[model samples]
Target: STWDSQGEFYESEGISKESVKLALKGSKMREELFDHYYAEGGEEAVSDDEMVKYLDDNYLRYKSISFAKTKASTDSSSSATDSSTDSADAANEEAKAKRDEFLEKAQGVSFDDFDSIIDEYNDYVASKKASDSSSAADSNSSASDSSTTSDDTSSVAESDTSSTASDDTSSVSDSTADSSTAASDTDSSADSSSSAPDPYANEKMMNYGTMDDSQKDTANGKILKEVSGMSTDVATAYEDDNAYYILIKGDVKDRDTEYAKDNHEDLLKEMKSDEFQKKLTSWVEKLDIKVNNKAIKRYTPKVVYDKQTEYYSKNNNS
Candidate 1:
């Protein structure tokens, strides 16, 4: 027996120290006073007094928690809260009813029926192109009809100024030049009129080594990065913020090798030039470099005449 803080001999044999530790481990309701009473650093039973205190404290804590919960429930069951909840419920029901009515009109959406729908658009563009060609032919026919009116007008002018034939010819030349210039300025360039632009033009054969973060995010870059590992004909259904897309991968070619064959030397030269420029800039910034303004001005080609005169002088000397 040991004299505790209470100065009493509290013996224990029912609960082991290991049992108390295990109970405390699984419980939030712990009395650290138990540690003060019987928590020795060895295998021994907790004092019966400490065990009694632990159970009593846990029961008191449970009662207090239950009282707090009951008070909260009573406070929250007020008329205002109930009215707000009812209003929210009514709003949700009304929104659901409207959605149901809309579904009745749009005839209910179906899953597993969505696609890129690009083929239909391509067909529509081809039809429009054909119609535009027919319209252009009609416009050319109208222009041909206008030319007959111009012929009669020109004859009338020629007759009125019969003696001044040279003057009339000069006037006609000026008029023709103005009309041609106007036509040249106003006429639209022949639009591509292509049924479809090359889809692969934007994504074919990336030089992935030179790509930066921004480049990796552009030109279907995200899609290409994924498909780079996949074999041809093994595609993925990809989606983004705007729309869903089905990426059908094409045959792999050593386009990178072919491109490097033609352009590797030029690319290397450009890289070397860029690196040299960066190094030069860094060196210039660090070094005490002052420009000889007099020398620069003396050698500077301010104008072509300034250099041309020297060239002429050299030629004269030679």
Candidate 2:
């Protein structure tokens, strides 16, 4: 149709009217004539066949431009997809790096150090017990001296008495001596009882520093697991002051004497501190744990044992 239209336009120009009519007579003949005309330069004196060839070449050029535009669009889409994929991969890698760093930090702690500290505390308790016993012994010696002086004073008073002074002095002196001896015996018994130190104090104090490395590792693992599994709200709450208080309680309770001597009101105040809870929650989060249903359902005996040991140690020291 385009070729016929071009032939009509050529005839209206009044040049080669006969050739244009012959060219349009058949499609095959027109195509062959157009090729032969195009072989020569497209000059002003060009034949109708040459003009048809020119128009067909222009059409091919337009098709090439369209094809180029389609190719560019496809390439752009592919590049965008690749960029998105690369970005996602980078983000995932960063997340993994963060997780690994947190795990490493948590795993670095040693429970053996904690145990050694507890041993030092136990030694301190033993020394304190010895000092208390010494003080008790000193007090008893002073009491004994005062009793002896009182017995001598009573004997002198009887010696200065009237008629039965000799008999009274002897009888009174004997009774006074007997009373003094009995008083000394009673004081000695009291002193001995007071000087005896608590048997469990040293043991309890020792527990504070006695955690094993394996136990600590296990605990660190558990903490990370828990943090990983926590919901946003619960995790936030865990990092608050309440959690810190629990850790402090666990720590202080490990020292038996300190726990016993510590005021209940003070403990309550510490427990209520927001900072303590926040510290605890932060610590737990730092563990970078992820807990699943299976881990929760199956109680880990080693963890339980460590916890119980910690509690016992705290209570003993307290």
Candidate 3:
């Protein structure tokens, strides 16, 4: 038995003296330990230097992080075992149950039904793109007009403020220059408008009505671009009670890709539009599905613990 600083006594499993030797030799066991630690910590997992120090300083803690959860499930659960693992299992099961229920409800749905939904979503995207483009064009036109107005006002002010004949002549010259500048600005705006790419190119929705049998087969089960205003990649469809989902696999435009990268969270939030979710909620409610929370909580990961701890004394030294 070993007594911790908390005055709690627990059964002691003696340290494995071969741990440091295995780690130094780059053994497969040590690699497995690193994998567990990485999985637990994700992108913020300890660096190589910090990992060595961590292994040396808290060898038992490292072992617990690696294998304690597995051991607890096989053996009886102890107060020392993390309770959060139970909650994680419950959450995962709840999500899975919801997805299963959704799948069940979606069964018997036809390809035409999926097509209609996708078409509606694509039309919405097209309308939004058109509105945005119009607004931008209007803004540019307004800015150009405002600049021209400013130049006209300045010319009138120079003529009003003039006292000498030379100043009056200068005012006339300024007015002529302003007219030329305004003309140049108009030409530039026209040139830019002509060069501008078609905003509707990426915004065009797929027409299911025009698709042939081969095209339909090719288009099915592909990833759709997020710019389509559809939140899900797959459209649920089934034939004769067999569920076969079709994925929207459309090419993503460069503009949409850049926008998604710049505003990832915002784009996601937009994708989960209130109207789309309300429809989803209505469909789920119609199914009258219910989940078993108790059953979900009962499903936890099987745990196994390793009794090897080679560096017990190494903890205090660090």
Candidate 4:
């Protein structure tokens, strides 16, 4: 009886026996049902027996069609959401990769290097401040002393002239007083000149030496060669004063030279090793290198022009 009622309802709703059968024949019944309903108009007449049979055969099929459509719409919405999430994830991954690259570039720099630079800078600033303060005090003291000397000179001149004028009325007194006044003026002038401080005496000369530029270059080269273990000629040519090179020569010289002979190769290997660089970086971080009394937390040395050229040439070749 329920089947019969459903069949009547189907007939009223315009679903036919053939349409019901077609819809039942495939999983894509919702699409087929819409096509069939539209094709047959809003209502299609059907026999009560045929309608009852159709309803009995495809009742679940109609329900399945409805469910399928809802599922498809939900699936489309989910796919769109998933696509957005995937794009976001890809963007995040790209950003993370860039950050990792930056960190890698920043690696090997130690806190000691920063500290060393900072300390050096701070010391330089302190020295400058002290020098400036001393200069100021010296200038102020000189000014005060100059004023007092001028006043004393004026008083002496006034007293000497007054005594001479008074002595003019009495011949012996005038002559004696005039002579004494002249002697006093002469002595005072001499003393003042002798005691006067030379302003230029405190000023330092800028020139370090009279040695020619070529001689200076040669001297610098020798120093660099001794410190860097490079050829004297090459040192002269390149003028490398890197601390790494200096440390290497100082520390590794005994191991590599004929003087040491033993484990020369091993020592050389160690000097040029990454381990040495790491150790140096660690040491620098610990020492906290300061330049001009300023603390340096981070610094990157400029790549040598030769190295940059080599890198570009290699990349181009590749």
Q: What's the TM-score of each model vs. the native?
A: 0.27, 0.16, 0.17, 0.14
For model 4, residues 1-318, the per-residue Cα lDDT tens digits are 333545544444345666666655664653344334322232332333333332222111000000000011223588776775675445444433432433343234332222232233235435545665677667666666677555653211111111011211101111122111111111122234476743222111111122234533553333322333332111111112211111111112211122113222222232233434465577668996658533232222333444445655755652
* Candidate 2 per-residue C-alpha lDDT over 159-200 given as tens digits, one digit per residue, 9 for 90 to 100: 111111122110111112211111111112223457674322
Candidate number with the higher lDDT (1 or 4): 1
RMSD of 3: 32.1
Give the higher-lDDT candidate: 2 or 4: 2
* Candidates 3 and 4 compared by lDDT, better number: 3
Q: In model 3, which runs have C-alpha deviations exceeding 4 angstroms?
A: 1-109, 148-318
User: Residue by residue across 117-190, what tens digits does model 1's lDDT show?
Assistant: 22332343355456656776676666666775656432111111111112211011121121111111111122
**RMSD, model 2, all Cα superposed?**
50.2
**Predicted candidate 4: what Cα RMSD to the true structure?**
49.0
- Candidate 1 lDDT score at position 8: 18
How many clashing pairs per prediction, in order? 0, 29, 13, 31
Give per-residue lDDT, candidate 4, residue 60.
Answer: 13
Using TM-score, give the best candidate's number: 1
Q: What is the C-alpha local distance difference test score of candidate 1?
A: 0.34
In candidate 1, how many Å is residue 35 off?
81
Candidate 3 lDDT over 1-318, as tens digits, reads 112331111122322335334544665654454344343353434343443332223111000000001112332466434564564445444434433444454345442233343344335435545665677667666666677555553211111111111211101112122111111111122234476743322121222232244433442211111213332333332211111222222233322333333333332223233434575577778996889887555543321122113233434442
lDDT of 4: 0.31
Clashing pairs in 1: none
Name the candidate, 2 or 4, with the larger TM-score value: 2
